[model samples]
Target: MNLSIRWKVTLATLFALACGFAMAGFLAERSLERQELAQSHRNLDVRTEMVAHELRPWLRAHAPRFTDPAFQVLVRELGAKALARITLIAPDGLVLADSAVASEHLPGVENHRTRPEVEQALAQGDGSDLRASQTTGERTLYHAILLTEQDGSPSIVLRLGLPIVTLEEELSQLRRHLVLAFGSAFLVAVGLSILLARSLTKPLSDMAAAARRLADGDAAARIQITSRDEAGLLGETLNRMADELRAKIEEVSEDRSQLLAMLTSMVEGVMVLDYRGRVLQVNPALERMFNVTRAEARGRKFSDVFGHPQLALLVSTVLSTRVGQEDEILLSPSSRCLHIEASVAGGEQENEACAVLVFHDITELRRLEKIRKDFVANVSHELRTPLTSIKGYVEALLDGGKDDPDTSAKFLDIILKQSDRLNLILEDLLQLSKIESGQVLLRREPLQIEMIVERTMAMMRPLAGKKGHRLVENIPSGLPLVNGDEERLGQVLSNLLDNAIKYTPEGGSITVAARHVAPGGSPAGGKSESLEISVADTGIGIPESDRPRVFERFYRVDKARSREMGGTGLGLAIVRHIVEGHGGQVWVEGNRPCGSRFVVRLPVQPSDQAAGHPSLVPTK
Candidate 1:
């Protein structure tokens, strides 16, 4: 049923050629029959004239002798040569002669006067007919003429007839020849039709195949036809169209690759949404920023994936207004601050338009901004308090206190103390800033833990004794030497001891201890030894809520009492920075029986010198 064009065309052409050849053969056969019949009629007419001329003399000499031997002999001779039937009749409708009959049979011949040819000849001088002969009972052609005498008087009717079978035989031969010729021509026509159909359809078929290949993604598919016909032109057009399509596809593919690369490499989160506010595409950054995968986000609503109502609203607003909108929104679960910009990103039609949302996380920037504000406020307050004291003391001295030596000296001392406190605060602030900025270079060397503790305790013992607090040292003799800056490590111990002494009451006990800890026992794991030092005191312990922030710059649990006791509130902060700079950890915990304990852990040196130091006190 799926016939190719070639066979269809070939079959159709062959059918038409067959019909034409058949019709031509029929017409040619008919024309040849007519021509042969006419020739036969003319030959018979000539024979009848000759026979009539011969019989005229006979008919005039013996007008009534129809059975004469001379006449019969003459008719026989003429009929034999002409291959025809001859008949002669008198004007009285009596049989005269018949060439086809014997002499004895001639007498029994029927009257021929009423015959169609004879009757016609009598009436019109000459006529012809084809019919079955009366004498011979054979189908015959009859030609008749009215005979005339020398005086122009009609004497007898001369009739001539030839059998139609001879003309039919000749026509049959011509018909066979015509049929053979037309059959041959029809066969040749079929071959020629097949060739012509192929010539026309071959190029079209090739172009059709090439077009199929092109559609199937073969960019190089082409038709090889080279004729100057319409099919050839069509083939060339198809090839050109294929080339243009291939180039356009390559260009589009390259553009897509470049666009994908740009989107993947961008740091900002980007999402594309349809007109219905559904997610169409989300880049990797967007997936990561929103904590969702592209598969999970696709086809879902933007608000559902992002879980940010403000961002979803912005997208809707931009889509409705056909304008760009930007706002900062906080993303939940992670509570990240993001600056999001939404814009319409398609054609002019509202249905064709899509929303593009681009955003970046600004949480760190926001946190730094808050820190800057707090630092400025704290610095202003710290500077103002000391300046206010100095200002008040100077004002008192100016109000006649200078006239009294005692009053003036006392005012001057108060001013000096406030000025010293401000200087201490400024120095502590500068030190903390240097350590935080990574500008303070550490002298990293191995130092005995007990020596650092002993130096710190020696400095702080007098202060503890002034408060009647008992000072105890419980350092293990074989404690490992820690890797650190010796002076910075000593300051760390001194600060903890000083805080303990400052916060403890009379009769309270203060203890300093150090121990060598294995790698697994130390918080900093993996095959590294450590040294842990603790300063414990029976004092008003730090609340669990304030412990985490106690090490922050200028953070104080008891601000008024710390100031009254000549504390700058930055000592613990400085201790923390120094310890962390040496890759150590410092933390505070509640001491047993009602006080707080501050502990420091530092990585220990692996050298043999660490094993030979003298212990400052026995382990207890």
Candidate 2:
């Protein structure tokens, strides 16, 4: 049912060989029969000619005496063993003699003039015919010749005939021999056909198998045929084609792998789009930066994924002009700023062009630039205010105010106060810069939280007293010691108390309290223990909106009031940096009824023993 090419070819070849041998055998048999028949006929003609010659004289002498015994003897002698019958006919169309019969029975024979051979002899001198004999009922060949008398007149017709049985028998023997020879030749031809079919089909079979292997992804499959024929040439060509295809496939695979690696490893977000503005590829960084998954991003429009009109416009521009473009765009919800660069990918036809977009996040860079500009402006304004005051006072002293000793003393005192303010501003700026730049080193030690609070309050008590504000300390006893620089901790509390004193009305009160907290109770979750210190005040309260940014550098909710009260805005900024450097957090809250509350939480020292103090502090 599924015969291979070899068998098919063999069958086809055997069929062809058989047909050729049969045709050749048939032609050979026919030609041999024709040659045998021709030779037989020629032999019959020669024998008839000889018999006719022998009877010519006898026929003349015994023209009408066919019953003569001597004449019958001559006719019988002439026929001899060669001819089946011999006869002589007179000119009167009567039977003269017939060697096939006795002389007395010859008179009963049919007339010879109407016989085809005799009539032809009379007209053409010699003639021949093959027919069934009327006299003996045998199949025979007849030949007749005209006999002329010595007087040159038509005398008698001499006719001779031979039965064809012996000739037919000889031809039958020849036909049998030819049949055997042709059969032998046919068998030999069949064997040779099988060999030829194998020779022709083996290489093609191997080639077919090799093609299957190639289809199944076997790159090394090859035909081993060594012939110089068409099949061999086809095999060579197929092997070369396979080699080329394998090399091209491997090259493409390697290039794809490298491109994927580069896209994955890059920090910049990358995306590729087709000419129709459909997303074709998106890298991991692009997915992360845009907050999208590959499944959600691919095949979607570029504008839909980024949701930024500027980015979409850039893509459109690059696609239209086949050029590169760059712009900065800000993504919403996350508020991330990205520097996007778009370009039409090269080595593509105009109809098949694609655009590539790369996103570089620059949010932090933009923030730093804004900070630098604000810092310079704030510093210049703060310095100019103090320098202007000092300069005005010195000019007053120089403008004859020195002539009055009292006036000169007042003017000099004003210059000294402004100079002190300038010095304080400079010191605060330097300290903030050191803290922010990581230049400040801490002498970390375990210290009592209550002692740090008491010392800071004592230093600020006079200022609060001058403002007629109450300064109260609610730090519980047996509080756990915090791991911090004691001097820096004191400075933090001092700044808080001082700010409260300056901002509060004369009758309002400020409270300082401390408690021990467990991990997860505070923002520092990994610490074993922590201390929470609160500096709450009834003062001109900070707005809820400004609370989050109170610790930013030079950020002041009431800048005019801050300056009037001899305060530099760097105190809270410095406080935040110091607390965070010590692994703590500081935040502001709205005080009850009025004013602001600042809470500082620091990790407690591991070596401190627990004193079993209550974490909740009573309100004052």
Candidate 3:
């Protein structure tokens, strides 16, 4: 029941044609009917002229014989052929001869001169019209003609009266034909209109269906039409338009997908703001980076979310100028400082719609930068303290304190101690710089792990005994050989042991243990061997919060205690570097009942080398 455009147009066109044809047929039929009536009247007029000519000679010969039998015979013959009634009127307007009734029985009519047709016939020789007869009272077409002698003088008026029923009967027959033609034309017009409308509207309906599918997000929808007319042209154009739209939409979708992927993949966070400085879209990386959810980030104003006036101002400035800007924005509320670089993009999107802001989280970079600055300051401070002490002691000795035996002895001892402390600081600084700069190379060699631990422990045993703490060595007798630098490994053990002795209270125990663990995680594959070395002490353990950063350079868990014990805070950092250089990992754990444990695991040997070497402690 839904009418299509083609059907509508076709219906309209066909209806117009039908109306035009109907009007033309009606007018043509009416004109034909009028022409037929005129021809009939002309025929009747010619017949009346013949009758008048026939009787006019008779009347001229004898006026008293007006109702003669010869005239009656002539009128009867004329009326029979012409389908009319002929009346011969005298010059005085009397009905002289009649064809239908006996001439004697017909009443003699007077005032025949007053008749319009008769008067016109007398004056102008001919006249005709439909009228009622004066005596007969019958409707007729009155055709009148004047009778003239050979000299052209008017005499009697011959009036021919034709009944109107003849013309009416012909008209009725024509009307019947017209009705039948109109009925047939109406049926044809309706059928052709429906067919034409269907042909045209089908393609439009298909295109409409395709458009609906496209609106529903189906890019593959298309209309199929093959013709050369305007409708076909429309279909082809619509299909092409749909194809182009699908392509453009697909391109945009792909670009958005790629943009989303890049944003999420980036370690740096990004935020986009609209012209009103409101957060519009955010990626997961930004959410994780800012520690905010998508709901919290969206619909929030920049200043409200970031709580930074400077950042909001920067965004506004970039938007106004339609240029890219870069600056470091601090998120003080989140306890994080970020080095951000932002750019203004798409400020002129049809109505100055929106701009983009990118955030890069450089928190670790900033922290490292601070550490570098602090390292220089701390190094200067530490060196300056030792140098000032040495300078004061040397100045005292030069100012004659050397002349007094006890005073000079104490001053010289103080200078020597300060000099030793300065040497130790310089040495540690140099070692730390070399390790950090990758200038120190490990001299890999086969070395006994137990021998190095025993030597370091022996050096620390005197101090441990002075504090009345037990120092125990638990190295397994058959431990596998470790592939590492002997001096570096010795240094690692010595540092861990020294810290244990310093932090442990009197009567606390320190234990050094080494065993061969599985080598599956080691570089020396195929052979299953790893060195498990642990230094445990029954001392105050480091807090869990401070454990992760324990290996950071110049990081001290107990600053005051470390300083009092003459610790440079670089021991664990050096230990980590050395351990990792040997393909090992080092971490600290809490020992039960108030103690700390530092464990180191290393590969037995390099996988690229042979399994055995001289001077290496072999497994029993």
Residue 235's lDDT in candidate 2 = 84
Model 3, 1-620: lDDT tens digits are 88657766977887797788778778977897688778878888788767766666666776546556776777778777766788777777878776665766667445576888888877788877677776677777788887767665546677778776766677777777877877788778788877877787777788889889989988888878867888789988988998889889889999999988898788777788777777887778778866788899788877777657778788888777877888887676565766667676674443343776667777788888998898777777777877898889888889998899999999888788878877887888788778767777777676778889878888888888999999998977867677777888999999999899999989999999888777465333535567889999999889989888888877888877876787777789889888887777898999888889999888786555635553432111
| Cα-based TM-score, every candidate | 0.64, 0.67, 0.66
Model 2 vs. true fold: TM:
0.67
The residue-by-residue lDDT of candidate 2 on 433-539, one tens digit each, is 77777777776666888887877888888888887888888977888777668888888888888888889998889999888898789864654678899999999
Candidates sorted by TM-score, best first: 2, 3, 1
Q: Model 1, which residues run further than 4 Å from truth? A: 1-268, 283-293, 332-334, 347-353, 520-527, 606-620
The lDDT, on a scale of 0 to 1, for candidate 2 is 0.82
Q: Candidate 1's C-alpha lDDT?
A: 0.82
Best by TM-score: 2
Report the candidate with higher lDDT, 2 versus 3: 2
How large is the C-alpha RMSD of every model relative to the true structure?
Answer: 9.4, 9.0, 7.5
